[model samples]
Target: MLVAVLATALLVGCSPRSEPAPEVDVTGGAGEEPSLEYTPPLTISEATSEVLWEGTGPELEDSGPVLLDYRLQRADDGSLVEETYSTVPKPFTLTPEVLSADLHEALDGRTVGSRLLLLLPATSDTSSFASVMVVDVRPTRAWGEPVEPREGLPAVTLAEDGEPLIETPQGDPPRSLVVQALLRGDGDQVVEGSTVTVQYTGVRWSDGSMYDSSWVQGGPESFDLGSGVLPGLAEGLLEQTVGSQVMLVIPPESGGAVGGEEDTLVLVVDILATSAPAPDALTEEG
Candidate 1:
């Protein structure tokens, strides 16, 4: 869920790939530097319908969905705000229902690898007075499937019903596989527009100390499918028949948004439950 944490609310907010690696981030400071020249504000005519962005790599246009490498900053003082480098692309689907006409007008059909600065008014008194967001865009390949592994990471197989299959030896208490299925179901595995609930533990690829996990605390973690999680995990779950336990070895790139220093991330994930949204939930949105 890319939904901004507005005190206490989550927002749920795709694509294909290729090419040389993209550069990840930039460093800068808050408060203005005396000699540096800032780009002048463009007139509405100059802004046009095309979107401009900041990034390093080939510019992608008409590719399916776009992955983004970005750094948000303060416009006035040019201060660093936030940064993200992910294996998956962030989406920018625009529609009036989800975005205001002004926003759609600001970001439709923009080219990839461009850097854009969008100024937004603060929503409340406690927030900053204004915001300047810099975005770096890169489009994905249509129907973009994740890269298949040849080496580096170990792999898991899914059952006929799309649930992850656990290699097991008949034993009491099911010592090998957990009770719940991770990524199980009788339909298209890992649909883009769905929510999935599962339990998982993540370990550092290098030394194997746990960095993060929902399973250790007990209870499953639920998230919307195909929403910029590690591609391998999403794809692996899609192949399962719901209600089956599956253990997975996640390559650094496929395990989380940011690449880990370890060679691979090992996971024991159990798909605990699934819930499909109502038809209205499938509407095209920003």
Candidate 2:
């Protein structure tokens, strides 16, 4: 839900509109360096796509956390416009706005580890440009490694689909915020200001009313922890290692934000990944 992520926690989700993957031609297959070559049609008037290579991994579901390495080129001449080959594959949550309608139609039901090429027909609208995107889908974490459920505080359980089932603990809510790490990762520690990608769920401490859930949305969400976020979230997330799942019980907001200011908030944050450290303005004068 793009519902005030600063005031509310950001989660991922997709709409009910989706169709089966389309069949198309791709130049390369899995286990090889990915590549795609699309010959522009002589009578191009519509967008079209083909699967350059098929992945043997799981078929993508409607709501997704798909990773892709894509190269964009002009549809008219196939001239390179941009690419992600130098860097790592990027993550694309299967949300309604993740891509343009034409591209979304191309990606529906594509498998993890598949490669695809999308060819766009010249646009009648002046606001957009026609282009081709060569995409290499990669496998990403479906779920964090399971850890023993911690007792005390609210008990957290997982559904068959990996969505968190929070059982708010009985007792007077903590006067101060609480942070507890459930699972740990060997990846980079979450530094202050690092763009952190995570899956999370938030609920009101009063009646256990869920306010947000990434699992429900579709996949994981990324946020800059260093930005002016909630005191409870910044405190709970800063310096925590990536791949760690932490629980936070906040004692109501004292100032600006979404959600109830009097209602104590509870959050289960899973630090799935981190990237793009905030640029340093602290450099000494050269």
The TM-score values for the models, in the order shown, are: 0.32, 0.62
Model 2: how far is 51 from its true place, Å?
4.4
Error of 2 at 103 (Å): 2.1
CA lDDT of each prediction against the hidden true structure: 0.40, 0.61
Instruction: Point out where model 1 deviates above 4 Å.
Output: 1-190, 255-262, 277-286
Name the Cα RMSD for model 2: 8.2
Candidate achieving the largest lDDT: 2
lDDT of 2 at 177: 71
Whose TM-score is greatest here?
2
lDDT of 1: 0.40
Candidate 1 residue 229 Cα shift, in angstroms, is 2.1
